[model samples]
Target: MTDLTTAFERVELPLETPFTISRGTQHTAANVVVRIEDGEHVGVGAAAPSRHYGETAATVEAVLPELLDVVEEAGDPLALDRIDARIDGRIGDNPAAKAAVRIACCDLAAKRLDVPLYRLFGLDGERTVTSSFTVGIDDPERMGEKTRTAVDAGYTVLKTKLGTDDDEARLAAVREAAPDARIRVDANEAWTPREAVDNCEWLASYDVEFCEQPVPAEDPDGLRYVYERSAVPIAADESCVTLADLPRIADACDVANVKLMKCGGPRQAVEMFHAARAHGLETMLGCMIETNAAIAAAAHLAPLLDYADLDGSLLLDSDPYEGVPMPTGLVDCSALDRPGTGARRA
Candidate 1:
């Protein structure tokens, strides 16, 4: 048997611009990259911890130490379900940590088989989807400038951050900046039902594609109320954490935003996809403020989703790694033909 071990490092990615939402402002993304080595092949994965889901960089680092023995005991990396169950049995609710290990396992398995990660699940990378580049909350003029810049760079879709008294002005600025680009808004769970519906109606006039987490995450009744009355479709981000939460929020949201950091990893993220389809809910493959590892891992599954918000790496000032091909909002997934998830330290 090969000696298996895991290791990780924390890197701070400086955002080009400050990202603000209902919660707070962020200038840097504190992300952790996990690596699994068997003295033969190596697997790698990365994740950005969010306080909204109760995980932080420190916590992710702390709990990751336990996964070494678990993965060593699990043995085969392609035994996806077995790896997931074994890790789950050892650890409790640290989804981000579990995600890192699961991603690494998949990467190692794919490299061992000398195939792309998507090939393991019978997926196609040719049919890629357009991802949305986010413009975080800022002064209307600044946001408009950012919006214009992104559009000029060939991004056809834009996800604008809202959740302030300036939302009206911000939307107006973004609309003025990119009249022809498809628009979506994420309020970060900041409004009441009435406020969300009223805002949605107002947003409808701008031809906004959808509103994400318009109301607070814990208020299902409020979400349902907004879903019932809002003219714009509602896509749940914070509201849908795992598969169990999917059924609960299906009636409250038109779409579910699945992040591997929030769910376990590829194995569990796929479960979220099927569960969303079973519930007749639209699916969006989203990401945290991440690097190429998590983004590339998610990219392999892009052709199977209704929407994509995998621009986390694109928002960085200087990315320390390389994996998938990202040309603005487009995902040139042919870069994924490499073994494993193709995320390598640069």
Candidate 2:
């Protein structure tokens, strides 16, 4: 077994524009990066600390040293389930921090095993999803402009934020700007069930592929209510945090948007995808406004995704780390073949 040394850093990734959801707006993504090394090979991973999950960059940093200490002594990085068990049993609900550690460890193991991270999970490198660039909540004109720009930038799919009173106008504007683009909408749990049904019916005119988190995270019954009345497919984001939440959410929505930060890491994410499928719900690999390090780690599992909203790194003004490349607005796992999770300090 290789003697592993682990370390972490807090990174501030400034977004190109402020990202707004129903809960709030974010100008910068406060994330944490973890690195695990064994003499010759280096593995890197990152975490997006979500406020909705009650996690912060500070909390990840504070929790990591203690957590990593346990892993160093008693855990086996190569036995992923053991690693996850160790973290889960000891660490409790800090999914983001546990995700970073799991990512770094798996990255290191993959490098040692001399295979790409995808191969480690028995995933096909050829299968992948085109990532949808998110256009945060904005005025109709501004959102339309952003949609046009993303379309011109080679993005065929556009996911727009819509929660406020002007959602109809915003969707209309985007529809006008990128008439041919596959559009998806995320409400971030801002509407009442009745309001969501009304919006979903109105949104059908825009050809929206799906509506995410249309009601508050706390109310799956409300999502079910929306599901019963709306023509547009409802996808659960905040409503589906981890595998534990799936049984309930699986019945409430058409799809489950699984984020690695919420699920723990790529390994657990794979589990969530299958579990979602087993429960007859589709899956989308979602992300917080994150950096390349985290996004690349998640991309390794792209073959299993029905949809992807991995434009997190694409939203950054300048990312300190670079991992993988999306030449055609879709994650090309071939681009991430270098080693490990393909994340490196830029």
TM-score versus the correct structure, for each prediction: 0.97, 0.97
Residue lDDT tens for model 2, 15-101: 888888767888999889888777888778888998789899989998999778766765456867776777777878888998888
Clash count list over all predictions = 0, 0
Misplaced by over 4 Å in model 1 are: none
Model 1: how far residue 331 lies from native, Å: 2.0
RMSD of 1: 1.1
What value does the lDDT take at residue 106 in candidate 1? 91
lDDT comparing candidate 2 with the true structure: 0.86
Best candidate according to lDDT: 1
Residues 25-136 of candidate 1: C-alpha lDDT, one tens digit per residue = 9889998998888778889988688888889999989888887578887767777787788788888998888888888889998888898888876778787888999999
Model 2 off-target regions past 4 Å?
A: none
Candidate 1 yields a Cα-based lDDT of 0.88
